[model samples]
Target: MGKRYTVPARQGLAVRLKKGEQVRVINTHGTQVVDSWAFNAADPTEFMSMEHMRQGINGIIPKPGDGLMTNKRRPILTFLEDTSPGIHDTIIAACDIWRYRNLGVEGYHDSCTDNLRMALVAIGFPVAEVPSPFNLFMNIPVRPDHSIGWEPTVSKPGDSVTFRAEMDLVYAVSACPQDIVPINGAGLAPVDAHLEVLAEA
Candidate 1:
């Protein structure tokens, strides 16, 4: 049987999967965003690279069957299905303390970078190995003027996206805690998310 985990709002979790294992991420309450990062289990230095994915997939927004590449240009994960509106964005970097400071926020705030680092570190990754994440369920759309704009997620309860592991990997996910931004359900609150792994038949 596959394992299941619940990532609390503003927290993070780590999942290790063998090659060919499938993972499904569910937005339990709809409108919550999950920032996720993937790493090659054999070599942590060679992690997921958004630049490579952009170049390889060559799409403003990735589609089903698009392979998410690593820093070494190897396919790490293949997007299998999306039950939502299929509007997740891959262009933005995960949130961090510096970003909060830039926005005039005073103290330490929950950010994806911190969350991913904490989660991965607990799973044995070094503190210096943080990488950019693939923002799942995030709604950033390119405008007609060629600029991007943020919008609330359209994912409803039970909406989900599943991915097939192309290679053995350790994945990290953070339920974003940007309570001051509209990205988290109209800036109201972050909600819990569900994750589960499935073995290949």
Candidate 2:
């Protein structure tokens, strides 16, 4: 069995993945949304790009067997498996301090943007820019009028998604701390998630 790591509530964690290795992200509580990112181990500047990925896939959300594209227009990771309802977001920017302030927060609130930085720094891999994250299990419904709605996650407990590293990479995830909006769940509570690095066969 692989060692499981916890992505603490309202916090972030990062891990290194070699080529062909797989990482399985678990929604332990099934009510939290995990903001995920990837960067080339060789060059931090060549990181995952949602815009490029969407253009390559010709779709909004990625599914199993899809290669996650990078800013350099190359594959960094491949979606291998998903046990959840397969709902994720590639459009929303990671929440930051300004986002909280704009949401009328009085003091500091945990944000995914900061989480990503802290996680990378913890792993001795810091980047200059904060790219938009792949919001795992986030439910953002686009209405017919071209509007979007924030909805709670639809995944049940123990749901997970697995991805394969197409190249050596640094993977990070933040247990989103958005309380003002109920994207995590109707309870508006953010919780810890788990991840396991699987060996390549």
Candidate 3:
């Protein structure tokens, strides 16, 4: 078993993954939405891109065995396994303070975008513009009316999704702090998540 790392509630964490290695992210409470991103270790600018991934996968939600495409139009991580309902999102932008402001939050609100920035800085990586993350376990289903609904995750406790590193890269996760919305759950409470990096078999 690999050492497990805690992604604190309302915060972010980042780790390095070498090519061929795999990392599994766990929804410890089954209620948190983890916004996730991967960046090339050699070039942070070449990070995961949801737009490209949608084009590559021919869908919005990537399934197991899909290669997550990067902005450079290459695979960054390969979706390996999903023990959840596979209700992840690729269309929403990482939540930011501006988003909270619009929701009538007067003060600084913990946001996934800020969490991503801080997490990268903690790992000594240059902070860059927030990319559209592969929102693990997040549920934003498109309706027949061509609109979307922010629904709670359908994953159960201890559910996880695993990905294999396509190249040496930095992976980040934010146990999203979207308290104003019910996306995390009906409770609207964000909680901790976990991850483990596995060595190549």
Q: Every model's Cα RMSD, please?
A: 1.3, 0.9, 0.9
lDDT of each: 0.86, 0.94, 0.94
TM-score of each: 0.95, 0.98, 0.98
Clashing pairs in 3: none
**Candidate 2, residue 53: lDDT:** 98
lDDT of 2 by residue, 53-101 (tens): 9998999999998989999999999999999999999999999999999
Q: Which ten contiguous residues of candidate 2 have the minimum total lDDT?
A: 1-10
Cα RMSD for predicted model 2: 0.9
Better of 1 and 3 by TM-score: 3
Summarize candidate 1's per-residue lDDT along 1-201 as a digit string, tens digits.
387789999999988889999998999999899998889888889888888989998875677899999989989999999999887878889999998898899988888888888898888875466677789999988889988877789889989988988989998899998777688778569888989889874
Q: Which regions of candidate 2 fall more than 4 Å away from where they truly are?
A: none
Write the residue-wise lDDT of candidate 3 on 1-201 in tens digits: 389999999999999999999999999999999999999999988999999999999999999999999998999999999999899999999999899999999989999999999999999996657888999999998999999999999999999999999999999999999998899999989999999999986
lDDT of 2 at 105: 97
